[model samples]
Target: MHMNTYSEATTSQLPIPPTMDEDLENNTEVCDGNNAMTPMVRKKSELVVVANNNSRLQMLRNFMTNLQEVFFGTKLVVLFPAVPLAVVANFYSFGRPWIFAFSLLGLAPLAERVSFLTEQIAYFTGPTVGGLLNATCGNATEMIIALLALHQNKVHVVKLSLLGSILSNLLLVLGSSLLCGGLANLKREQRYDRKQADVNSLLLLLGLLCHLLPLLFKYALGGGDHSIATSTLQLSRASSVVMLLAYAAYIFFQLKTHRKLFDAQEVDDDEEKAVIGFWSAFTWLVGMTLVISLLSEYVVGTIEAASDSWGISVSFISIILLPIVGNAAEHAGSIIFAYKNKLDISLGVAMGSATQISMFVVPLSVVVAWIMGIRMDLDFSLLETGCLAFTIIITAFTLQDGTSHYMKGVILTLCYIVIGACFFVLKTPLIGQSPKASFGVKPSFEAITT
Candidate 1:
């Protein structure tokens, strides 16, 4: 009954034309806007034009925004060169070691600025290219400092700094990130992907093993004979090449084959999302690298005199102070991300950086020293190697469950403090010198003369 009533109402509302010609005439009137059809079509056409204009404007605005993040963002730190430049000038003119020290310290923020630019570029590109860019210049400040130290033939300092970097990342940076994240989300456990952390741990172990083999060959098994020392050097050289190759392969794994396993989820930071072009980021990366290298030269040149003036050992300067300053940028970044509850990115920055330093920076330093005619072997002091191994083992165990807490962070930090204290009193030994005591006892002048 309802259907029949609705049908009758519809039929009554329709004004049926008596002839086909009359119906055709009425349709024409509607199309020409004698009725509502023409007005509706005009409104739709105007809406399309407005939408097109808005889209083009937005694209232009994004381009401008990217330019600012890439270039202008760097201006804050890039412009910081004036301070270092003056310090360097004062050092040369007045011959002040302190001035030279401060000059390099000033470059720290610039190094961080370069890292930020790469991050912005990564945001514009996908994960693979971002990872590539990051891996390439991952530890710019550390690499530059180590290279300068190697240039001055300060092999002991270089090795200690490497151990310092590894320890700092595995313990200090990772610990701080966990603590901050845990505190940020109190009562909620922070978790990361266990598989990714395990793979990184394994790679770090590989690096430790590579360093360990030469030490075992020279000291433990071969009793530090001259012939054995020579072989150890040869082994170290071979291992450096192998480690570099492995580093390349690992890069392939992270950025290509199993990228998704390690890649961070897309974060929603409005600032990071700023549209920076690839060329712009590349230029800044290269430029910042060169500038940091120049500053590193000045810093290493005065390190010894500064150490003497300040009454600090070269080992302490390199091992503790240098790592903190060199990796300051990435370390701060990781902590910030963790505090914001972005654990994936935080973990990636902390762990990925350690792997890069281990697999890339250490080998590159060895190869560079070799090219410079320095017989820098992989014979680390027993204390350095043992502490490194301990740190790696503890870190692996802590991160295995993929869950983190404030207590875990405290434990890791305490481990770092313990190891750092040990290094503080420890003397810098001539690492490649053989047939000494079990620990890193200083080689006698007779040993050097012979």
Candidate 2:
């Protein structure tokens, strides 16, 4: 009876189990909590996706803005359409003259764009390295044309075009800059940094010496001597190596040890802000270089046909028209800067280009030709060499004083005009045995037969 009573007491003290209705309410509350968390997680993921899309959109917008600025920032952009036209004309076998004209128009904007891209890049590379970049790329048009001509075995075109570039920079571009600057600042004396001018002049003289030695070597031995021709070719190749080394040294001096000397010609303070990012500028430069190469090929390929159609001598076309057109952008820039009384920048643009062409591009062309098995030498015919010699001497004298006047500009302009006239009337055959053939070397490459 006691055991039964203890069991009953324990059973009475135990709690009761929950009902089905209470259990249903607890389950619904758990389900509600899970449902609420699902929406929050979904919203968070959607926001992340939206942010990613917005970032992509912003990048696309920036790209388009940069593209528009690159393509439409300049007045010359109007000529950009000519690039496609020329391509179409070439594809359809249109007249060579039409292709030539369109290519030239296309090249104008491209050349200007190249300069713009280089300057944009310079914003990141400091003044010294920027100046080096400018010097390297300033005559990119000429360099491309020369390389194309060399590829075609048109050594004469390469020589004449390079020579023309030097002359144009030294006389036409420099003279125009000086004339405009002197007239604009008639009351104030227009002066430039002589140290820079002197360095350029000395380098130019060294290049002249290299050119002269090859020509003299050929002439010193009687014409039609095979041995002499070979020796002259060897001398030219060796001289090219020396000139290249000298140019490298000049680059070092300008960019490293003597950087301060060129600081005076840095980009203007107002113009320091970059129009595009570093990689953007690099992309444009590479793209423009490729386009310039294509247009240059068209130009070199059809030069003779255009010359024939236009009734102009090939020399006149290569030595007069080509340089003027190829360097149009640089010429304009120098003149504009000079007019603003920034003669140092003007001088750097003009003299630096000339010096680079002489000491760098010309020799580089020779080396490139050598590599291609083309027998291009430094023996510019007596006529061309004489013109180069006179132009350099005159230019050296003009820059010696570091002071510029309108009269000095007038003199240089007149000199260019006279040279242009001489070439216009001169009817030297473009297709001939290599200049070395005159010295009796077996003709390895035809000259300007393209």
Candidate 3:
């Protein structure tokens, strides 16, 4: 389909037949009395391009909209620089400790819960009405959470945020979807793409490996208890590099052989049947992120001031708390979609975003921290590392059962619970120390130091 880029909208001497609507069959529209406007024809491969979509004015308008989301995100908490400034400025501020403690306890959980709730509604609709809607909402939720986590300088928590989401989507969401949907098809048990699933499954497997490898490296070096700096870099670099390769493979495989993964995307045929008003959902997503970001900054600032006084390790903060905040919406959405029989969408949520976070978010965070002169490491401890591997192995094994059941769902949920326990149970391995008694920071340092 060659498009004429001619200046004139209409000409009698035009060589090709007009693409404009030639019939009154269904009230197809004409733009500027020329090109046709089929606003509601839905298909699998294309978008409902508003006749004005290519016009300078419309482009400008949409660009403005997108700018609003970005600016709004930035201004909400000055997400990038705010926390570090707050941390540094604590030196000159009075009552800094009090300020930090109250702010964190009030802010982090509440903002994340909002995102989780908003996304849960969106997810309940499934791909039938809100597949793309859910994905967009998930991104929105993530942005809101990430911005807050970033502002707080809760680096480890943000990482856990990513991890929790990956685990939830991969295991619980996917498992539940397959279980319910597969049972629904008990007559014959319809199967989806095997080759694609196999490849995606591999990528997901590797992504989990990237996450876990960091922990293993840290442990091999006598645990995070030793302050040997190079070890952290080793974990970060290895995870980023391998995970990146796995992701690239996923994209290539998807584009080349398994285009159906994106089959649910809006197109010309189903245009009329589609009901999602994406822009509205996007707005809500952005709005939620803004509020969350503001709250997260305060949360981080307070946490820093209060951490030692509160007798908690920042490690515990990151590994357990951060993941819950960042991925709350995604976890809910994936589970709901699965329960509704939209298993493919569930897979997309789990595998696609898992890859995206491992390849994109982790590296980007590292780069951003570097630019900000933060010395955060994209590494993990052996315990945290083992959880990553456990998630991957369990997810793969469960899915490979070739039939979804409640048992699979139970397995996934249990993994999540066990991992959560580690946050409060496992003692933090500090540099120049050995693994000691189980966690529960004493008023004196004796418990951990021993």
Local distance difference test values of all predictions, in order? 0.76, 0.87, 0.53
lDDT of 3 by residue, 1-450 (tens): 134534454553568754445555234444423342343334322443544455767768766765454334322233333334444455566465555544344333334344343433444454323433444445444445555566556566566556555655565556555655555655654344344355656776666556555545554554334465566665666566566565566556555555565654322333333222345445555565565555556555555456577676655555455445455445555565656555555666666565566565666666565556665555544455567678777766766644455556666766676766666565554422334222232223453632
Ranking by TM-score: 2, 1, 3
Top-down lDDT ranking: 2, 1, 3
Candidate 2 residue spans exceeding 4 A from truth? 1-16, 268-271, 431-450
Q: What's the true lDDT of residue 437 in model 2?
A: 37
| Best model number under lDDT | 2
Between candidates 2 and 3, the one scoring higher on TM-score is 2
Task: State every prediction's TM-score relative to the real structure.
Answer: 0.77, 0.92, 0.57
The candidate with the higher lDDT, 2 or 3, is 2
Model 3 / residue 238 / CA error / Å: 6.0
Model 3 ranges with Cα > 4 A deviation: 1-154, 175-196, 208-228, 231-235, 238-242, 245-249, 252-257, 264-285, 304-322, 427-450
- Candidate 3 yields a Cα-based lDDT of 0.53
lDDT of 1 by residue, 1-450 (tens): 999999999999999757988888888887667547667888999999999999999878876776566546643456475555645576567554655666656666766777777776787677667756764566777887888888788887788887788788889988988887888889676777787787788899999899899877766553566787789889998998998998889878877798877665446555545456667667777777777777777777777777778766667777787777677777787888888777777778888888888888898888898899997888776667888889899888898887878888889988988877776675444554423643344443444221
Residue pairs with backbone overlap in model 2:
none
Lowest lDDT 10-residue stretch of candidate 2 = 441-450
Output the lDDT of residue 315, model 3: 55
- CA RMSD per model (angstroms): 13.6, 3.8, 18.1
Put down candidate 2 lDDT per residue, 1-450, tens digits, no spaces: 999999999888998788999999999999999999999999999999999999999989989988898899988888999999999999999999999989988998888888888888888987777766876676899999999999899998999999999999999999988888888889998888899999999999999999999887776675737777789889999999999999999988987798888998875577459878999889889998999999999999999999999988889989988898788778888998999888889888888898899999999999999999998889887788999999999999998987888898889999999999998887657533434433444433434333
